[model samples]
Target: MFKKTSIAFAVFLTIQVHSAQANAQDQTADIQAQAQAETEAETKTENNSIEKIAVYGVRQRLEKAGMLSDSIMKTEVISAELMQHKNAVNLTEAINNTPGVRVSNECSMCGVKRIMLNGLRGEQTTILVDGLPVHAMIAGYYAVDAIPTTGLDRIEIARGAGASLIAPEAIGGTINIITKTAIENSATVDASIGENGNRKVGILGTGITDDGRTRATLIAQYDNRDQVDEDNNWVNEAPNQDNRTFSLRVSHDLTDNDNVIVRYANIQSEVFGGPMLGNTFADGTATSVAKVLSSFDDIESDMLFEGGDVRNNFIGKAWETTEWVNTQRDELSLSWLRALNDDWNMTLSASYSDHTQDSFYEGFSYYAEDTMWYVDARFNYFLNESHLLTFGVDKRSEEMRSHSSGETNPAYVSDAFDYDVLGLYLQDTWQTTDALEINMALRYDHVQADFIDTSKPGKEIDQYILAPRIDMSYSHNEYWISRLSAGKGYRAPLSFFETDHGVLDAYLGFEIDVDKLERSRSVTYALSFDGEQLSMTSSVAWTQVDNLAMLTKTKKTDETDGGVPLLTQLDETATVTTADIALGYAITDNLTLNVTAERFIYDTAFKSSYAIAPVEKRLTFYADWDINGWDLFTNLVWIGARDLSDYGYDGYNQIDSNGIVVASSKKSTHAPSYWTLDFKLSKAITDNIDLYIGVNNLFNYTQANEGESPLFYDLDGGYDVAYIWGPLRGREAYTGIQATF
Candidate 1:
């Protein structure tokens, strides 16, 4: 998307800046504390919920809101108590502190990020908002960006195939984001400004009107800064970028047992590559962001020259991505609490979602729109006070299109492509005893995608996929808990197959479809111990992929196919394995800390892509303190992940004499350890106004690239580290004031 697309575009073109900030502080320990609060009362006759029994999703886990993770089913919840008090920008970074989870940021360029649940890659994790599928088929691997942290009321994480309640393909795990619910009347407004010209504002209000219940929230955030590519490199250190996000939501209790909810959100922005800031002659090559910044011992002189030079080269190569993301979601829930009955109840739910995406890179643009529907019903009957039989069924349908210039797929090549899918599933959750419980589920899907190449139109893909899953949990009374689970999942082929991207961070180098890929096995084990003000949790999980699919240029059917190479997903590469672990702590009523580490070992034979991410590890620190009308917190992270690959192909940069493309195995370079730290402070000045102040990248450390001068040196500044390693955003200061009625 370009700057001229909206008034925001004009602001982007005129302003050139960057940001160097780490994510929010870890607060899961706080979550463990809130979960201890038992639900007691209900709303006044007006509308309120009294804290009653706080059993989480246990009794009905994997039953309501598509919650796959619960006792007997294996899941975790981080509610509003944990979300509201902290400064969280995205889910990826926030979930990093969750046990057995990792925010594997694949590329540091142009929104290259994804959340890895239980060691599974972005493609393996399914994201749901209020029981509805938000990421379907082609669009996967978005954690924080798609959701505004402020709007979320709670987060539910389930490990393994999500059984049948969700789609059957949640082989690794599932994370469901629950939005705020209905209420009599409530209003909240948040506004803050931080270091590096950073500013953020949010407003949320909900109430029961004459007709129905409604809740709404709006968030506006901004960050701008300067950076020096330390190396005498051509790439930028921290390219300049700006962003804005807006969201709205409403829910209503229509009838005795019927309810409905709706949500809408949009995020738009412009990003200038710091690593892409140098001169290039068509071929991709360069120094790094770290190198450019390191070259100047004399900060003043270096800035004058480095600033102008980078701008000239950068603007010339400024590849603009003008994009707009719009989503419309609807959910309907019906529950039969009881009718002249004792311990029997049934709940049925249906949801639908529509997504519209349009992106323009350079002068070429790509657009795609997709719609999906989901239906689920569950019946629960109590055998006794200590046991219950819960069972259900689920189904979904999806239709999508990729369009440009006007036609479909490679046909208009510049046009759009379309496809459709239908799926069905079933599952059950059983409470064996007060101490033991079990959950089981299964699902099947049939989908067909088409490429409308008006020219040489030909059928490329058609497939039906099946998936199944099961899980169990044991609670040693109320203080100790354990869970075990397993499941199967798969990804069918699509028409746009092995295609191309207009962005640099586009991994895989081609389109996604090669051959129909399916994963047949899953394993997950987790445990938790809770104390009055302290809590602990640990988990281990693994997955195996069968009949994996990948594209290989070296083994192409016809090297002379003119680079439009023949591609297919095969059964040869199969069985990829992965595992993960985590821990958390609370020191005092005012302070909390958490730590989580994860590992991914790709089974070489399967070749499903993630191998390039290396043995990744993350260590985070958090501390929140309130004093004299002020709220302060500090956050830091130390990350280490290494790739074992070594590049050997020679003269690979040169095209054939006839301009034909030649290829070699994708190579990943070494990425050393990097660390970042940040801190924030907020003050309440009056009944109607408040203030926010903070510093990001407190160390001013960044991956070094480019050069402020010839004498300086920056080893960490290169595009190489972007995918494998990351540098600090650099030190920045910001301040802002907010008002309320």
Candidate 2:
């Protein structure tokens, strides 16, 4: 009895001692956290007047306000500082790492990509440069590659239908590129070389007048990369590219409160891909018939046995497979901003752009020329401290002329289309109280479209659309904010070039009616928190689309049918929902961390006909550290899998005796999830010089390898590069030097 009592007493004492140690550890952790918080609080108080825009490029981050004070839209700004830290080669590469934004590969032969936001297709988004309209119509697909970050100030992305106030076609989102203004004389040059035979060089120069009233800036860039064969099938997975661009901007201050800016840019690019290196027949025989035949013919035959269509009904013979892209584009823009008085301001802008494309794919040669003229006038009125109103009017005209020839009867044909639009908009912002704000905008647009078939002039189609938006924001305190917004977006009928590239000459006597305008309505809700060391924003949005235009197969009703297929426009409905959470934390005086999570879902009744494949969830993380003149930055992205059409890459479905294709037992296949990591390190040698090195795809991840083949071509013998889900190039390492004076 005495021994049992003594053991129980010793156990009780041991338990008490363990509890005391746990308490001590907890106390120590709390004290460290408190000390860190105090240091951050002191820093924030000192930088209260500074703007807290993210700085990642050559400059380091400075703790300041967490949000913008000028606008209420949920905008994410990426500065040139960040772009340099990420080692982005172009505008498309610079903006792709952000959450809710995707840069999609549309053509393997040309390495063409389009930017998408909030689960919507690339066509619904708008690209703006310095508040001017450009890169629309036929140029939208290939123009993103031409934009370089030589003299860029920043890039702003607003992800949602309601985020667009100046652009009516921004049903998905808006990407605005702001250029830097010269305040003092400066010059910068950089050069980089990487794996896969990649090479790049850029130069920028800025000069200011002695009186500080006039400034001029010039930028030039040259970049090239070799084609890569991911699967060792002799077929290029990524196209070879040779691109060059030159730009000039001049700004003059007419008065103390008035200024005018003029800008001009020219771009020339060439891209080459496919298995054939030169014009040659499938056999060992050499044939120079203005086109190249590739081994895809044999691959197509095998696909037919696996239930692939292999249909070239319109074109008389199976077209030869050749891939090449050539383009020339030029742009000029002018803007004048004047402050009429203390309570009023006026702005006027005008721009002209032209683009020409000469491309050939699978025996079909396509030539296109596009030109656009745009003008805008805006007036802002501050009626009182509580109310601000803006009125704007814009006029735009675009013309596209395209032609194609090869591999079909009556192969030579021309198509011409014209689009004209006039728009008027009014926006009002009312500060009901210091913490409550309401904003409303209404716009009316009239669009006129006409198509000519060289032989016949079609009747003109006119459409009138009304778009309205309302947004409200309530800030409970400096640390908390909430917002809600609803908006409507509209898109005019598409041009012939926007559809299939083979529609013109491939199909004899093909005809199509002007499609109805596409419209979208969306609503968004958001909440935000701001603190000395932590900042976060959470948002959810939903969008519904009507009269979505698409190309569909139809029976030919012409007298010379020739048993060929015809293409026509069809309308469909779709819904998209997106949710996002973004967080930023200052881990230490020289370290910062950021994380973002996004969920995107898309649904449509015409599931079989829809072509979009969206990921259900995505997560992105970024870290930046600067200490002792050394900077280190890293970015990681994780993408979730979703249902998508295999497109016959994983063997084909069985076909019955009947001509109709037998449906595969698997309706949808899950795209494999993927992760990519990138890192960069830089050291400042002097105030005006720096050295940097970076690695993209640090783990050598790729969707296709030496043994695996990625499906880049569809079953119908058409180019199908949209099935891309991951990186095509495995890894790239580059080092460069930047110098400023």
Candidate 3:
């Protein structure tokens, strides 16, 4: 499972120097200062509408930047100074330090490096590069890492559902990676070397032509590391891996009022980790056992002598074997923007992507392919000096074909899928007075699917989703404000769930009987103090997803309670309540302290008809403290887990009535809490060069489950299962030198 996605990403770079490469970028610095001044000057005239800060394009572009996922929060930006010190390979990692935001790696010790945005899973969130959807066909748990963060302006994160402007079912959130404009001719190259022989390199170049109106950006990155799982427990806490990624973006301002942009990117990555090799027996001789671990269901393992075990205790490997899992993604998209006037703007965007995977589990290999394309249009009208309106229409289609056949498993199948979606929505913002402002939005989404498989019933699913949001802010003074925001957003299942043929048999979330998808409604309240040198925001968000498709907690035979447990897609009502609060203080203008906490609760009974505590909580502390012009930041993250296993026998709702082998559904309720610390220091050695060092997982902590594969496997005989996720590398530290020339 070791390949690299970070290689070819470096080749796509356009080395043809453009006039925009001149990096004495006092212009960007001046523009930022002017934007800040303008915001301050209009802060009172706009009736305390400071949320409009940073919309002006200075060093970057923000055309597709919308608070698509949040109503209470407008567009936000984190300075590049904040990004320079961290190991930012993707947008999720770039925004990890923002207040009330989280980019969590779900299976940190796996073959694929996938990440979850916010609290929702990967499939639940939409990954948009320069406002275009990027389809990376990665192992479900490790797909997020394939995205390249080498050439970025900044990432915009919408914490709530932003279905009003885009497609529905962004139930968790949306991450939009904006690209830098060709403001100058500049190139930045950074290389890092760290623990476990880990090494990474990032190269970014941006150039502008056409008298500074046209811009081109190219970025490439590579990451390769050795495998070192020290526990010798037969499990690689984290697999050794290789990664390569590359992308190029070109933009031309057709006129002062119209522009067109095009971008292309690709990723190739691999990983390897398997069972440990050492075993203990009664005779003190080394022994191997059969069925030691299974990553896929269609393969047979001959590690041990079958029917020869004398004790319940099992000891096998200290890293005896490894597999190679490979994944690749290619994405292309084009966008056009036209400014009708100072108050009117229109944008059209289209994208095409192909995601391919050549993943192997010893004798079994899975080769899956997916291709998708979509187009969207947005229109914006400034109602007045202090009011704005936005509306849009979007259409998208996707197709996936999978040929999964193992050497020994006769149950393999080839499947195909096709899906289409269309949506429309509108939003309005108004300043009621100098002391108050309000925003309201609504959107509708419809989708259809076609599946080509004979083993499962082919069905067409259609859905109409509605999202509404309203946020009100009242200013008590120049330094104080109180706000209340309430919004409703929904998440539609991915095409794989409705159109992947038998893919649903692999997970419980897909096992649904209804013809419609699910929806989420939320409300949040916030209070903040914005002073001359400090900004503190405290917010609480609560949401509920009615008819959320959840896995059946109690196992049964033949789908019980009208629920599908075997990766069967279903629609069940679920309430996910989260309490979040954060504070960000800019101490002495050069330093900032940020801390956040969240309490999350999930409705497990909506699908199971039985109640369980699926509670989780998180706390993060981030600080950017500077010393003598050197910028340093430290982030500490912790996740409190709960026992989420329901060992119910069978795939049905009815329990075994026979007294002899009746399998009772006993649940395990306690999983240990996990914590990680990351740190980075950036020193501007010169105006054109920077020095940085960072450590990820300062404590070198790994996610260790106690004989449970729910996080990485489909235990119900569906998808493949993998145990001992290799040694989750501990204490990754890296140092690098970056220069802009």
Candidate 4:
């Protein structure tokens, strides 16, 4: 692995050197011209008699507040500059620092991270790239960590139902990742290494034609991390991962009023965890239960069952404790923009994605393939100088198939699904006055789904839905703004992989009985203040979801067949309420401080299948300082506690090898609160080079430190690997260097 990484780094350096040599002359001339222009501007300013206020990039807090106040709905932006300050390498690490957003791991073995918005699960959020829904179910499961931050310009977030015009399934919120547009010639490379065998490297390049009509950008990145086990149980607490990604984008002007953009991206990733022995045997065959149990002969018996008797019984079946997954994904997208006249404009876009996975989970072998296609067309018309009308039509189609084989069950096919949706929407923005604006929109959708399940009869479903939204923004004064919004949204049933991938190991098969669409209604109110030295924003929201899908397990009664479990869903209702506040103050010309606080309340009838409980309260503090040529940043986050018994995690029944209950152990009901601190420092060594160092989780805090383990056993002696609520990894220090030419 080290040799390969070295070779790749050498190639990247060679490319950068060649490009620098080619552009050296042009760069020198541009620098001289820029200095001359600056000198002339300074002279003009000195000669002028009138006084004027100067604006600087140091006042980014006020600028960001202005962006939020001017939008029709509440929106948040995460800039690339902030990501750099945090020393983030992937999308998950960057977004996790933002207020009102939570990223949690769903599986200890696979390390599948899920993004939660406004107290809702990851499945309810719609993730997009450049306003296109190319990250489908299978790919989305891993995209959060596989996507590199090398070429991102910014990220836009909107929380609520019907926040996007084209995506109707965004019951929780919408996240849009925007890429940078190349307008100049530049190249950048970054590399970092840390504890636990962590390593990362990335390169970004942008170029524009001399005619100023064509632009292009390219990015490549690689990341790897080793597994960690703190309890000395020969089981990993954190999964091992290896990821690689590449992307390219190009834009061209075909005519004076027409432009086209094309983009392509590819990702390959692998994850493994569980027993320390690895995923397979020496001969590349599946490891049997006897073979795995024999490897533990040297360990003491008491250490194996320290948690409880149920946990001990689970440990007896060693074959059901390992997991491994390998994935490959490719995406292509295109967009065309045309101006019909001064009052009318049009846009057409299309995208396609293919994802494939090969995996081994708990003595089972599962393979899957998924493909998606999407198209969109929209037109905007300016009417009477007071109103702007926008209308669009979009269609999305997806198909997924999987094959599975296990020790107790015969080889069979599962999760064969084909789904299609067509949507049409119209929106009008009316500027009633200079201080007030109103936006009203409506959308209609037709959904169709077909499923082929071997455990039960095939099923087909067809449905139609209508959604409406309205938003009003009023400027009370120069420094104050108030906004109100209400909307309705619906979501179609998703594939099995999107719901719970771990259930595949425990269940023989699944049945589809969903008869109604999952629907939601939401309302939000926000107030903001943007001043010279202080800025503040606050919001409150409520959402109610009906026909929420929930899963249930059923056991086979026949003796001839193994007593395997089958899974299905039931319709239910859930409600969520949230309140958030953020404040920023410029303490000095070179220092800034910020604080954010949020609270969430949930009323639901079903427990999370992944054993994840919502956090009730959270607070974060941030500080940035710049002195001389050095920059420093610090962050602190506090997470509140929850009642575990309320989520059905009270205790587990002790069972012997013959499945006989003997005793029970009560578990801790109340989880304690915890906090973490991070710090980073960077300085520019030259005009084109920078050096940085950082420490994450400075206190080396983890759940194990609090005597709480993520592994838990149930009444039936089946273990759950997703009982997590806090950080699993400890402190780590890293240093890196960046170069630009």
Candidate 5:
């Protein structure tokens, strides 16, 4: 069916192109005559008195109204002004409020979060900084929240497969963080404090050389938040975090048509969660069993196990219930752009990143180090007046090494591997007519991966992938526009962390079947309308993934050991279909209102144990009002229910050591829907300073309050901490001051 549709679409595009070319040729004489007439009339009016008419700030107004974008790919932009209104301090907080996008918490204990685009898993999405693929898989676990929003100009989001030309692994979508390039002699500082010991301070500054050829921008931020245990179970629902980030960007104009940019960034973070304690386990304060058990109360102690014998079995492993992670990341990137002539231009870019993590989970200690680099070269040619061609080559490589040790077991190396991908792509932008445009792209990637383990023989895998994409845009009139896109993309699975949580047992090792590749195809259609007072955008997308990678525990049998986990591909296919609509209206010159609605449908032949269940429906409403230098922003979000049984979260019976059922968890087939409200108000105290206050989750809505626990115990007394479906934190109020000089 897909092949047939593709063939038909190609035929239709060909017909449109031919018809446009014929029409252009036929109207050549008319266009020349009109131009001549206009010239003569202009000469006649030159001597007469002329009246000048000027219009200002129309584009800015449209952008503020959320109705202006000039990309053929149906991109969405989260502007800095919008981020300030929402009181966002990081990338995760900025994009989570956008339609058709979600950031979900994977681990309740450590507060591990991932972004889901159009109902796809986070690993499938490619995150880029200034159009460079410098975000590594290991860094992705925390970078979304760690990256500060100080020096950013905006974030560009494109959904569906093949959304990026250089990053072929973008099976879900792409997010590009664009930084400020034009420099001015200005500096801004902001500080805020909130509940739960939350506090943040940030500074951003930009400067230009006297010659006006070189410029630099610097940003630094520090953020800290304490842990929260709302249910008083001694198990924290949110982790305590201390994070610091620094970034610098420098740009130089070498010639009239040549420019170079250099960027460096660093992040340091420490996170602690799980059973509450007086101090960090890393400080040796809670390393002993007695110290660990002292933090728990009688209710928590009784809830730890089904019976006394089961509790006794875990006497010396009390430390296993806690988690701590320390992470550090550094990155550097360079880009050069030069125009050979008016018709030819090229770009050269490269980036390198290093990430390291030391962490312990459930009594197991693990350390990981990852290094990655990317290089890209692109050339563009203006073939004719209506056709432009782009050719590019990209090379990316990544290496990771990890070690794990249990409470009583010695440390052993695990998941030590490296992979490289070389890609070549060609894209063409054809302006069929004044009102129509189309882009067609094709990419080929060669991948090689090697797995190294001293205890076993090394394994190697090689694969090749081809991806194709097409996008079409047409303007019906000045106010109405439409777009359609389709693409095929693939990912070469090389690491166990891509599919499962980063948990390792000291005695067990992973066996990966790298013979198959994860592949996907997606189609999206969007229609938008822009007017004086009202704007609307509606889109629908469909995506299907084949050979999905899944981590499974081997069954114990006489033929082999069963407790070891392996990474394997599932035979069934997984699919997601989503529809989204957004509307914006200017109620008055100083007030604007926006509303968005999204619906998602998920289908799979097999159940998943770790993946977040997709929400079926979501609605959001936002209001912005500015009065006499005082601004107000408010939003209400409604999240729909999810099927718990679909993700292996069906309630289970708790059995004691004597093989007797002590308790049974209820079968929560469908989670309840909920709503949350947020508000921010800012006032200008002086010409250079502003004071702001805001509240998040104003109603104090949480999953625990809704009778759903993120931590669930199975029949054998083993607990799972991934059963999260809704918000974990309650109401939080914060106040801050911003100053510019």
Candidate 6:
């Protein structure tokens, strides 16, 4: 089916190109004649008064689209105006409408969310700030929620494997947050409130010194929300959160050709969710919220066993379990840029960051800390305009410490490690003609890792890797553009914290394969069109990953109960292919619409104990209208059904206490499809103030409607709450006011 669709799309593209060319040729004569008349009229009116003509059209939209389409590496830019119009409160909400990108909320307890690209797992994507890789270790999973959208210039997103030529960790692409610079003294404030006891406040300001040699920018934000329960089953569908973030940046000019920038950021958050008040079970284990919501429940079931009339035995029954996460992060960075004559420039940047997280799930406690230092230096040479060269070197050192304390047999299990990476890279860009450009990059990295375990006498691990990439772009005409890119990327060996967040205490006795590395090779092709009133983009990416690290259940020993699960890392091979098409048109002077369709096909030879993203297709539509002082924007999104059977949890067999094996519940295999509609309206109260209101999930669509809600129980009365496949929060309405000075 996918092959046939691809062939049809190719044919359609050919026809479109031909039609565009023919139309362009036919319109050439008309345009020339119109230009001649306009010139003659303007010459005659030169001695008279001049008049301003306002043409409400797609000029601004097309200009932004053109800038993105002309790049050698295909990139999608999300402007601040769009963010405000869509009422995006954070980075997660900002990219919800983007094709090939998804904000996946995996765990229900703490509401852990990550960005998934092209249907791949969240871990495959790399998050960056100002072109620097900052999400590492524990920060890679939970810290994404703390990033506020207070002072962003724009967000650049690359969707595909190996989308970044310099950052090898970008196997699933990159999300780079670009910061806005201060142009003059200004201040802004925004406040909002929503359903479910949600509230937010933010303030941002910028200033420049009288001498114009120094500038500063600062932003602060606070957000709080209660748990969300659409089904009203005494279980929270969305966790409660209290989050705060602050950032400050300053830039100073050292000389006419040199400048320095310093920045600092702090973030803190506390999130919790699970069974609330009045949560009680038939069994004598869990009675009230205070008793059942603070500890992990043991596996106990009343379901019939393999032997007729026999029931599974339970050791320690605790039905109440609440999930909680407390995290704090601090970062400081400094950078210096200098111009060496007219043809050369140099840059140096360094940063230090510290992150700590404390979490609890059903009485299981896990704590982790990560400290990292990074430095980068680069030089750029223009080399006479047509040719450009860039050389750079970077180094990073990170230390991770993780430990778990709970009622498990191990009592205490901890892992601590340190690693360092040093890399050198060179890139060259050549313009063969006025309409064609080629870019090539090569990089080499050396890594040294040391595991600290006094009981095992740890040893040092070292490895070397090489990466290469090539990108090309051609401008066929003013209305057509084409680009192609290919690259090789790799991720370093995983630490204890990266694998499972140190959840399972059984890992204390498990073995690990430290030599394995996750790597990928990918290729992509893109085509774009920009007409007088219409624009379109289409692209396809194919990626193959080798030695993919996957967590699996290992064999049990006599000392370990058959019920206790141990995790081990395994190497596997995987492939992902994705294709997407986007189209935009100006229906009228005050109305514009955009539509996108995307499809993904993933293949992995390894069948593990975890569930991967099962979504295969997505569709998105967006429309904006503006007239007078009122503005309206709307978005519609649809997701395809997924197969739960892919994770192998259909009536599985497990051992019982009597040394007998029994079959578990026969669960459903298919997750149904769902759709949502969001709307926003705003009106200008004054030149410096505006009021806006919006509704999300206007249809109140949810997975619960299909009996696939996150709240679920096994045949034996064992509760599990993390099987979410769709929107848990049904509907939300919010209103806010913004003021600028």
Q: Compare the candidates by TM-score and give the number of the best one.
A: 5
Clashes of each: 76, 4, 78, 0, 1, 6
Ranking by lDDT: 5, 4, 6, 2, 3, 1
**Residue-wise C-alpha lDDT for candidate 2, range 119-149, written one tens digit per residue:** 7777778888887787758776775777888
Local distance difference test, per candidate? 0.46, 0.64, 0.53, 0.68, 0.71, 0.65
How many residue pairs clash in model 1? Answer: 76
lDDT of 6 by residue, 397-503 (tens): 89987766532445222356787889998876666675676777888988776666553355445778888888877779878888888888877655543444335
Error of 4 at 165 (Å): 0.9
- Which numbered prediction scores highest in lDDT against the true structure? 5
Better of 1 and 4 by TM-score: 4
- Name the weakest run of 10 consecutive residues (lDDT summed) in model 4: 14-23
For model 6, the run of ten residues with the poorest summed lDDT: 23-32
Question: Model 2, which residues run further than 4 Å from truth?
Answer: 1-71, 276-319, 406-415, 454-460, 496-513, 556-570, 605-612, 646-668, 706-708, 712-722
> Worst lDDT window (10 residues) for model 5?
14-23
Off by over 4 Å in 4: 1-71, 277-319, 406-413, 454-460, 556-570, 606-610, 650-665
Candidate 6: which stretches are off by over 4 Å?
1-71, 160-162, 277-319, 406-413, 454-461, 495-511, 556-571, 606-612, 649-665, 712-719
Model 2 TM-score relative to the real fold:
0.81
The CA-based lDDT of model 2 is what? 0.64
Residue pairs with clashing backbones, model 2: 56-81, 56-82, 57-81, 57-82
lDDT per residue (tens digit) for residues 307-374 in model 4? 34423322333344567788888989998876565456577999998988887776566777889999
Estimated TM-score for each candidate: 0.70, 0.81, 0.75, 0.85, 0.85, 0.83
**Residue-level lDDT tens digits of model 3 in 1-741:** 101111001111100000000001111122112222112122323333442221223213222222121243432354454566566755555665354454433222344433333344445566667666765322233445555567777665555666225645666566677776555567889888888878878898977653555677888988777665444443444566678988888877665455678898887876654443243422233233233233234333333211212011223232223344567778899888766754566779998888876654433345678788889888777666555677888888787776644213333323455677788888776656656667778887777755555534665467676778776766688666666656777644434322221222332222333344556766666666655555555556666666554333334534332333332344545555556666566666666776777776555533142111222677877777877868878888777765444311122111122212212322233456778788888888865687888888877665342333221212232212222221245677888888877
Which prediction has more favorable lDDT, 2 or 5? Answer: 5
